[model samples]
Every structure is written in structure tokens, then in C-alpha cells.
Target: MSELAGREVRFRNTDIALMLVAVLPALGVGGYGHLMLGIEILDKGEPDFSLFGVAKTLSAIVAALGIVLVGAQLRGRNATSIPPLVLRSLSGSMLFLLATALAVILVPRSLNHFVRELQPLSVLTEVVLVGALVFLVLSVSSAWRTGLGTLMGINGSVIHALLSGAVFLILMEETSWGQHWIGFGTPEAFKGNLQNETNLHNFYTYRFELVYYSTAVLAFVLLPAFWPKRLPQMLSQLGYYVPPTWFALFALPVCGLMYESWNIIPYQIWFFCGLLTAVVIGRNDTKLRMAALIQAALLMLSQLVFLTLGHNMEDGYELSEVREFFISVLIAGYALITWRRATGEGASASST
Candidate 1:
């Protein structure tokens, strides 16, 4: 027991050390960009061959490393375990990196900016729509199998149907439902209040983004907490293969950083959703709960610090970048700890 505890401590210390190694240089580059270039690398969309560009390159590398680290940790391999899953994930990651590199090389510098701008929106639309379709299929299949009868005034199929519909709505809004694709002009009603002539999001109010993302937060993070069994059984099956950490990571980026909609509301939704996810995953475990609380506190504190300090800078930083950075680190930390605990629990269960 003492040996096991010591090993765990050593492993945790190593993980922390690696994280510091990963983050410090990135932060240094960010600070340098802020001080010299008057740009926040993590938030800027401009593609220039100046200090800003260097900062963007470095930041991207760091972000990729961070993602790889999370993938490694969530592969469920400890010191004694062979890392087949980790290797597989790493290979896929390498292929993605290779493709990105090829694109960068093949595309002209003038067109690179255009590619970068379109990539995020395209990726966001695809992910959301695909997820919605999956959920819709699962919900329909589950309802078909279980019969769409209500129990105690609550219907499982109805809840899932709502989730699917909401996600589809968000997807439509994101894509403007082929309005932009089809090259049609904005509607007259939307045109009068247009924030940006070309952008649909700016045409309407920020309320659109808020409602869509908030509904997502509620369905995926909050609703599951209130009634775990409310989720489709087919969807729940994913938990066996994909850890909650992946969802937390994916949602954190999309909720806060994906769209430039409202100020801080999207981030607040992400923050709470993360906290709720921690609570659900921790269950009745005191240590896990404590860790979750600490993570939440730290996330809030970091945001406060960023907002306070950000105003002093010339080109004020994006709050989303700050939110994303802190949440990613916190998610990685807690996910690793919870993963260890889960493995320990499983081992004990099997022994008993």
C-alpha cells in the first residue's frame, strides 16, 4: 500500500512537471506578444509575418501538445500498462498534424488567412451537426425499443428529442441554413439590425448565440446530472469508450472560444458546465469532490485576474482565450486524478 501511494505521488509530480514545461514557454511567448506586438496570440485571427505570426505559430504548437497530453492521459494506461490506446491516438494525431503541415505548405500565404478563418466555422458546424444527428438517431432508436410512454409525467424520448432539436437549431444558425452558402442576401428584418453585413450572427442579437449555447450546456452537462437515466442508453454506451474528460475538453473550447458572440456569458456557461461535469463524475467520492471544488475556484480566480489585468493592455486580450487556457489546464489536472481513482476503484471491485 505504501509503495502504491508513493508511486501515485511520483506520477502526479511528474505530470505537474510536464505541464509546467508545456505551459511556461507558451505563456512566455504570449507575454512577449502582448508587450512588444500589442497582440494576444491565442485570440488574434490575423495572419501576419511579424511577431503576431510567430506568437500564433508557437501557440498552435503548444495547443497541439496540450491536446496530445490529454489524449495520452485518457488512454487509461498507467506505468505497468502497455499504451496501445495511447499509441493509436498519437498516430492519428500525427496524421492530423501532417495534413495541417501539408496544407500550410501547399497554400499560398495570401490564402492562408482565408483558410484559417473558414476552418474553425467549418469544423464547428460539422462537429455540432454530426453530434446532433447521432443524438437524434439514438433517441429515436431508444424510444422505438422502450416505447414512447411517459412515466411520472416525464418522457425520456421527449427530453432527447428536445436536445436533438436544439442542437440542429444551433447548427442551422451556425451555417445560416445555406443562406451564406447559397449566396442569398440577408432577410430585410435581419438586415436593419445587422451587426456585420456579411455575418448572420451579427445580423440578429447576441441572444441567438446565448440561447443556443446555453441550451447545449443544459442538455449535455446539467440535465444529465439531474437525471442520469434520462440520457439515451445508446448514447450512454459512449462513456465506456470515451471518458468524460474528452467531452469536457471539446465542450470547453466550443462553448467559450468558438464564436465571438456575447461577452463572458458563453464562458460562464462553460465554467458552470465544467463544474457540473466534475460533480457528476466525482459522484460520492470526497477526494474527487474536493479536487473539483478546487478546480472550479481556480478557474474563477484566473478569469478574474485576466479580466482585471486585460484592461491595462493596449490591445485588450480576449476573455475567451484566458478562459480556454485555464479550463484546459484544470480539465487535464482533474481528469488525470479522477482517472487514477477510477482505475483504483475498478481494481478493488474486481478483487472483491
Candidate 2:
């Protein structure tokens, strides 16, 4: 009983600390970003460097807390709650809306409204506002069962942190300090990281980064924790090398279609991890693994489908985009079939 009591206290403290850490930085720096824009509103109305800098730093700190929370939560068993879930959604939404309102109110009405050209204040505003919104939506739609886990799901908040960091780097460029801070030409720097096939001027700055990261938070962070045993089982029966090849075939071309310059290395790493999970799960209870794999694949691939359509132009987009879609279907579908096949009586039903 004493041990049980200790565990309970620990959970409470961590939860409270994580929750506060998740929001404080956003609120604090978000306020500063607001102040910078306010400066623009008052004087001849130019962007304020000092205010923007302060805001970005704080915002990054807050988002890093969120990532830490998510990672820590993932290490435990599935645990999520209704109140925490709702609060997470609210936090993301409120931040996004507040930033949007400030941008409209503070930034001059005549500065060509270039999302790319917006000041640092404008950049941070965009990050928090959109970052929150993405997390909110992802959290609400999640299948996470624990309140804490749900709030910190991979798709829940970690992806938002990644997106927030990307935007921070881009905004820093507008100031001369972009070099001093981001190392200017470092491989991780905005220019090098975001320089994709599109050569988009604001690859890191684009609002799409918000959308991409939000979706990713769901895929990379959330899916693994919930993966079924059957998933890992199937892959093991067939052996390890095959699944990675299969996953790569599907993930790569889709990356091309999504066009967001996502870290391919990271994406591939996660895919193999998911596949391995499927194999492990499949070895014991094939049914559980198959179901988990399908759900995960659906959530991840479905998001990519939306993004691909939205980003790609209709003019010359090739039919090859369909290949990734098909490959996802193939891998996930096979798991379902094998699970049912191994389960005997459940085979046909599972396949259907």
C-alpha cells in the first residue's frame, strides 16, 4: 500500500509539472511576440527584433517541454483521460486562435500580407496558433486510452514541437541573429533543412509545416505505443529485411508527393519500427497485431493522402502517387490476412 501511495504521488507530480511545462513557455513567449507586434502597431509600425527574439526563445522552451512530456508518457502503458484530453485540445486551439487574432490586429494592413515576409512576432504567432490547433485536433481524434498518454501521444504534441522549432529557425533569419543562433549554414539550419525539390523560399516558414508536423505527431509518436503484437509477429515470420523494404517502397514516393521536406531518415526509421512492432505482436496474438497495424497505417497514411492532394498540383501529378497508397494497402492488408489465417476460424472474416 505504501508503494502504491508513492506511485500515485509520483504520477500526480509529473502530470502537474508536465502540464504546466507544456503551456507556460507558449504563454510567456507568445505574450512577448504579442508585444513585438504591438510595437509595430504603435510606432511608424515596423517589426520589433528584441520582442520577437524574446518570444521565439520562450516559445521553443515551452515546446521542448511538450516534447519531453510526450516522450516520457510514451514509455509507459496506454493511459489517457477525458479532462486532460479536452484540456490539451483547448490549449492547442486557444493558442492558435490568439495568435491569429494578434496577427490581424497588430501587423500592418499594408505590408503585402506575405506570410513569408511577416516579422518574427508574426512567425511565432503562426507557430503557436497553428501548433495548438494541430495538437487539439490530433488529440481529439486519437484512440489513446490514458489521459496522460493521450495528451503526450506522438501525434499528440511532439510533432508540434518539431514544427515550432522549424518556424523559429526561419523567423530568426529575418533578424541578423539568424546566423549567430542557427549557425547560419549548419545542416540543421533552416536553409539546408528545408531546401527540398521545390526550393520553396520559406520551406521552413510555410504554414504547411504546421500542418505536416501536426500530422506527424500523430504518426511517429502515437502509433508505436499502441501497436498490436500481431504486427510484429507477421514480420518476424517473414523475416526482418522484407518489411523494411516494403515500408521503404511505400514511404518514399509518398514523401515525394507530400512535398513537405520531412526528414526522410526519421520517417524511414519509424516505419521499420512500426513493422517490427507488427511482427512481435503477430507472434503471439495475430489478431491484436493486425488490428493495431491497420489502425496505425490508416491514421498515418490517411493524413498523408490529405496532404498530398492539397499540396500537389493537378496539372502533371503522376499516377505513381497511387503506388505508395497501394503499398500501404498491401503491407497492412497482408497483416490482416495472416492474422486471420493463423487464427483458423477467423481467417475469412478478418480478410474481409
lDDT of each: 0.39, 0.33
Give a tens-digit lDDT track for model 1, residues 148-267. 423344454554455456545545654566564576787666665544334456554445445545554543333322222212444433222122332332232223322122222223
> What lDDT score is found at residue 49 in candidate 2?
29
In model 2, where is the ten-residue run with the lowest total lDDT? 39-48
Model 2 stretches with alpha carbons more than 4 Å out: 1-13, 35-51, 77-212, 222-352
Model 2 has an lDDT value of 0.33
Task: Identify the runs in model 1 with alpha carbons over 4 angstroms from their true place.
Answer: 1-117, 148-159, 195-204, 222-283, 286-352
The sequence of per-residue lDDT tens digits that candidate 2 reaches over residues 1-352 is 1122223112346666776776676556545545754421112111122555445434544554454444344222221222343234323323432333333334423222333223443444434444433433343323132222112224323332343454344334333234433444443343453532222344544344344433443343333332221323223222211222112212222222222222122232233334333333333333244433443444345334433332332321122222222232333322332222323322223211
For each candidate, give its TM-score against the true structure.
0.40, 0.26
Give the winner by TM-score. Answer: 1
TM-score of candidate 2 relative to the true fold: 0.26
